[model samples]
Target: MSEAFCLELYKDKVVVSYYAEKFHGRKTANGERFNMYDMTCAHKTLPFNTIIRVTNYANGKSVDVRVNDRGPFVAGREVDLSKGAAVKLDMIKTGTAKVKIHIVKMGANTKQSAVSAAKAQKIPITPSKGTAAKSQSAKKLVLKSGQLYDIQLGSFSDENNAREYAKKISRAKFKNVALQKSGGNTRVSVIKVDGKDVPSVVKQLEAKGFGNAFVKERKK
Candidate 1:
């Protein structure tokens, strides 16, 4: 159930990136006015309002960020920190960091770490080809391959608009992210998973206020 999923905190080693300051004042997927100076983050699947600890490996710096937006539209990146987070991690120059993330708490519940650290699975975060390494702490969690129900996040008359939306959807943090260019529309790419996961995925998106999220059959 959604409530149960929210109660469990997820831990993962993911390639972390930052949101552009240009979107600082724009509306987030949760209908929030984004402020890049705040210590916030954008995650794909983590429940909105969740707080996480992000540790930057390059500088050995870490910071706590609240999940307020979604994305890192490109693959291999799991979390997108606001400028303030990037500054805390000293990642403003390289623009990316290999880091560890711990879900510190769920909304109104500060006890997630007490349970999550003991029970949360550490999913692998794929780094750039230059930085890829083996993870021995936990095995990866993946949906079984089958007839996956693909969801079209958006279709835009302008290419930039589509790409922008795709980036936001990427914050959902699923590895099988995709994009297709046809004439003008760009949508969040599809993933191949058993049809059963569709409802759950949609529900998570809905919980975050993405009411238009839906699933459709993939084209062969």
Candidate 2:
């Protein structure tokens, strides 16, 4: 599925952002330590080790980056580049750019292969009964009112880190900065609004240095 998706995205223009220096040395989704100097990138669904050529539309500069992690997570964005790749494309100052992507090599880590490997080891693919019950309990908290959109700043595993980040955002004069715990992670969101205002809220958050800010829909 991802192989076909990659093929279809070839030569298509995509919005991309670069990782901040604070993320250097952190463990990536593939269990590799992220080095900002490496020629690597992240895509939400691309197989690990997939190599893709990204060309900046404005400057015509190109860099071949290996897919080593997952996310940009925000809507309207496709790839997240390392510092080296961003420097190569001359996008450090601008922070984000429109680029064209061409898959140079397809990776071996496909969904089907993973499922087959799990089946060979007799690993369970479905959730456990307890997990399903927990999910049901969580769903009971959902509001029955109309949907609301939240401009999320970030998510963290530590409650202290989440609170500190939320405070920082609040100090910046961004109103309604709040934290919510879900799925063992704490999420800091700026404000909730109607669906029609999501784009403007996202733009404001991005201008305030929250480039990865995305929308989260919830019943209100």
Strongest candidate by TM-score: 1
Mind giving the per-residue lDDT tens digits that candidate 2 earns over 1-220? Answer: 5343444245457789999689899877676889999999986445678888888999988888998876665556778999999999999999999998877676785533322222221111122222111111123122112446566666655566567667766776778889988887677887666555455555566555454444455655
Give the clashing pairs for model 2.
none
lDDT tens readout by residue for model 1, 48-139 = 68878887767778788997765645656678899988999999999999887765677552343435333432222233322221122233
TM-score of each: 0.53, 0.49
Each candidate's number of clashing pairs is 4, 0
Q: What is the lDDT of residue 212 in candidate 1?
A: 38
For residue 17, model 1's alpha carbon misses the true position, in angstroms, by 0.8
Global lDDT of model 2? 0.66
Clashing pairs in 1: 44-171, 44-172, 71-171, 178-189
Clashes of 1: 4
